[model samples]
Target: MRVGCPKEIKNHEYRVGLTPGAVREYVAHGHEVLIESAAGAGIGADDSAYIAAGARIVGSAKEIFEKSDMVVKVKEPQPQEWAQLREGQILYTYLHLAPDPEQTNGLLASGVTAIAYETVTDDRGGLPLLAPMSEVAGRLAIQAGATALQKANGGRGILLGGVPGAIPAKVAIIGGGVVGLHAAKMAVGLGADVTIIDRSLPRLRQLDDIFNGRVHTRYSTIGDLEEEVFAADLVIGAVLIPGAAAPKLVSREMLSGMKKGAVIVDVAIDQGGCFETSHATTHSEPTYEVDGIIHYCVANMPGAVPITSAHALNNATLQHGLALADRGLRAIAEDKHLRNGLNVHKGRITNHAVADALGHEVHAPENLLYVA
Candidate 1:
């Protein structure tokens, strides 16, 4: 199998799909690897490094897209990139198609087999492929919110940790999943008063035990949500619903109840944000003010730290990628986890969550792939 990676072209997105080490792994698997020139530039791996890893460096993204049997990427294909896709080529990447009908249409029109990393599941029912980036984005949420809370950034001019004579800034995190847990870790580390709201009582109890009462864990109810969000100086939107678009937990009217100058870091922005006001922003322009509330909803929050995120992502994706490279469609048929990752295949939506979100008919992956 010939696998290819192209340089990411998203706004301020610096993460690479394949790193030198990952390329070496593919080479070790007896597969030919093609990396577009400077594809690994964001992760500081130059052409020489890829060459040393036994990867052939191609001159253009178009060449990589045209020749590779399977295209491995960090982010979803941009308009131009998606336009280049053709039938039979495998597109293994993060396809947040639930919120973007245009991209979904593009994939369908191209007749490409699209396997979304975000929907890939583990035996434990966890999103294994999305976990690494989620962890990175979760931690970055606190950092971004803290910066946005500065007075110069149109925030309330309060320090997140606060001084001995001053009160600490309050942080409300909605969700007790990987993102929320990591956000709470960072916020609490900064000495901010933190509260995590979730509908799962068992998960809330687990978090309370983990934090040992350091951070408040509240049951997510309308009154509780309003009280916590309104009182908080920073609110981190960390909710997720697998391949589906994130539920809009914070409405436009609710913004009026939040504290003026409050910061909202929607870590769920990739799946459309939990905040009603969120539209994808780039790192170049990360925050926008809405009703006196600051929204930091950069769609690719993990891209801000490409080195760490790229390596972490590579680690999680390595095994599944190897499976695809070795057996192609057969890999998906054999592995249920990888099959769950199949969002679109041969012009049809294969993932139920994505199909429902986009109002498309779902093609059963079982019907599409022959395990035998």
Candidate 2:
């Protein structure tokens, strides 16, 4: 099997699909690995490092896309990269297809077998591949929200953890999942008053136990959400719906009711955001004002810390990627969790959530793969 990794070309995205260590694993499995020149530069691995790991360094991304049987990447293929995809080629990456119609349509048109890391599941019904980046994004949300709350950034001139005489800033997180939990940890660690709201009572109880009653847990409701949003200095939108678009919990009308200069960090922006006003921003200009509310909606927040993000992502994805390299579609047919990762295979949408989200016809993985 031939596996290829091209440099990530998204705005300010630096995480590569495979690390040198990951490449070494593939090579050891009798698979030939090809990496674009300096593909691992974001993670501080040079061409020489990949060469030492038994991966051949290709001169250009074109060469990699043209020659490899499977194209492994960190982010979704850009227009040019998708254009280069051909029938029967496998694209293993985080394709947040529910949000981006253009990319989804392109993949369908290309006839490529697209496996999305974000949709991949574990035996525990958890998104294993998406967890590492979610953890990073959740922690970074607090840091980014704190910065966005500064007066110079057009936010209320309030510190997250106030001084002896001042009141601490209030933080309201709108989910109790992986991202919300990590955000709560960061916010609470800074002595900020934190509240997490979720619909799942069991999850809320778990959070209460984990936080040891330090952070407030609330049952999510329209009235409760409004009250929390209107009162908080910072609101973190951390809701998710697996492979579907994030439910818009905060509407434009609600923003006007929020405190003037308040900050909102939509950690769910990758899945089309839980806040209605969020448009994907880059690290260079991470925040924008909407109805007097500041929004931090960087789609690739983990990319801001590529070194840790790359290693963590590779650790989670390497095994599944290796399975695909070793046995192609058969690996997905054999593993139900891996089969869930199949968003588009051979021009059909195979993931129900994604198909419904995008208003496309859904094809069962079993039917598509001709599994008995």
Candidate 3:
């Protein structure tokens, strides 16, 4: 199988799909790997590194895309790259289709076999591929929110970890999953009072056990979230719905009630945001003010730290890539877990969640592919 690694082209995106080590692994398995020039430069892996690992360096993304049977990427394809996709080509990437109708339509039109990394599940029902980036984004959520809280950034001028005789900031995290857990851990480490809300009591109980009373957990209702928002110094919207649009838990009215200078870092912005006022921002211009609240809604939060993000992501995704490459889609079509990653195959929406989100009929990949 011929695999291509293209440099991420989204605005402010610097994470590459594959690393030199990943290339070496594929080459060791007798698969041909083509890396576009400078693809790994963001992660500090030069073309020479990939060449040293037995990868062929290509001149352009067009060459990589056109030549490879499978294309691995960190983000969804942009408009220009979408045109390069051909029927029967395999795209393995973080395709957050629920949030973008344009991307969904483009992939449907291209007839590529799209396997979304974010939707792939492990045996325990956790999103395997999405977890790594979520961990990165969750940690960065606090960092960004704290920075935005500085008076220079139009915040309340209060420190996250207040000095003696000064009150510490109140952080309300809206979800108890990976993102919220990491955010709470960071906030609590910084001595800020942290509260995390979720719909799962069992999960909340687990959080309680893990944090040992260091972090507060609450059952999230609109009223509960509204009250928390009003009192919060930093509000981190970390809600996720797995291959679907994030539920808008924080409404515009809720934002108006939030304290002035409160910073909101919506970690789920890539899934269409849990905050009503949230819009995708770039790392270059990461924040905007709405109703006296600061919003840090950078869609690709991990991209801000490409070196760490790329390596972490590749660690999680490489084995799956190899599985898909070695076994081909026919074998994957037989595995229920891998089939769940299939978003679009042969111009049809193969994932029910994506189909429902886009108002299209779902085609089971098993039905689309012939059994050996």
Candidate 4:
């Protein structure tokens, strides 16, 4: 199989879909690898390194997209890239289609087999491919929120970890999943007073045990979240609904009750955000004020640290990627977990969550592909 990778073109996106090390693995597996020139520049891997790993360096993204049987990418295809897709070609990347009807339409029109990394499940029912980036995004949320809280950055001028005789900032994380857990780790480590709210009592108990009473955990309720949001200095929106649109936990009216100059880092912004006022921001201009509350809603927070995130992502994706490269649709037919990754195949939505979110009927991949 011929696998190709193109450089990410999103705003301030520096992660390459295929690393030099990852290319070497593909090469070792007897797969031909093509990488567009400077595709690895974000992670400091140049053309020479790819060449050293036995990957042919292509001159342009156009060539990579046009020639490769399977296109591996870090972000979803942009508008121009979408037009280049064709029937029978495979697109392996993060496709947050629940929120973006345009992208979903583009994939359908292109007749491409699109497998979304974010929706891929493990045997344990965990989203394996999305975990690495989630971990990165979670950790970055606190860092970005802390910076946004500085007075010059349009925040409340409060130090996250207050000094002696000064009260520490209150952080309310609206999920107890991977993102919320890591965000709490960073927030608590920085000496902030942290509270995590979630709908799952079992998960809340797990979080409480993990934190060992260092941070607060609350059962999610309308009143519970509102009370926490109103009292918090920094709010991290970390909720997720798998491939579906994220539930908006905080409304615009609720923002009026929040502390003035407080910061909100919506880690769920890629899935359409858990905050009513949230809009996808770029690292170039990461924050904006809504009702005097600072919002840091960078959609690609992991893209800010490509070196760490790219390697981490590649680590999680390599095995499944190799399975696809080796057997293509047969791998999806054989592995239920990998089949869950199939969002679109041959002009149809195959993932139930994505289909329901986009108001389309689900076409199970098993029906779409012949089982070997």
Between candidates 1 and 3, the lDDT winner: 1
**Residue-pair clashes per candidate:** 0, 0, 0, 0
The sequence of per-residue lDDT tens digits that candidate 1 reaches over residues 1-372 is 999999999998889888999999999999999999998888889999999999999999999999999999999999999999998889999999999999999999999989999999998999999999999999999999999999999999999999999999999999999999999999999999999999999999999999999999999999999999999999999999999999999899999998999999999888999989999999999999999999998999899999999999999999999999999999999899999999988899999989999899999998987645
lDDT of 2 by residue, 1-372 (tens): 999999999999989999999999999999999999999998899999999999999999999999999999999899999999988889999999998999999999999999999999998999999999999999999999999999998999999999899999999999999999999999999989999999999999999999999999999999999999999999999998999999999999999899999999999998999998999999889999988999999999999999999999999999999999999888999999989999998899999899999899999999888634
Q: Candidate 2, which segments miss by more than 4 Å at Cα? A: none
Write down the TM-score for model 2: 0.99
Name the lDDT value of residue 305 in candidate 3: 95
List the candidates' TM-scores in order. Answer: 0.99, 0.99, 0.98, 0.99
**Candidate 2 minimal-lDDT segment of 10 residues:** 363-372
Error of 4 at 112 (Å): 0.6
Error of 1 at 20 (Å): 0.5
Model 1 alpha-carbon miss at residue 309, Å: 0.4
In terms of lDDT, model 2 sits at 0.95
Report lDDT (CA) for all predictions.
0.94, 0.95, 0.91, 0.94
Candidate 3 per-residue C-alpha lDDT over 1-372 given as tens digits, one digit per residue, 9 for 90 to 100: 999999889988999999899889999888999999998888899999999999999999999989999999999999999889989789999999998999988988999989999988889999889999999999999999999999999998889989899999999999999999888889999999999999999999999998999988899887887888899999999899888888888889877788899999999998899898999999989999999999999999999899999999999999889988887887577677788888888889888877787788988787898756
Query: Between prediction 1 and prediction 4, which has the larger lDDT?
Result: 4
Task: At residue 165, give the lDDT of candidate 1.
Answer: 95
Higher-ranked by lDDT: 2 or 3 = 2
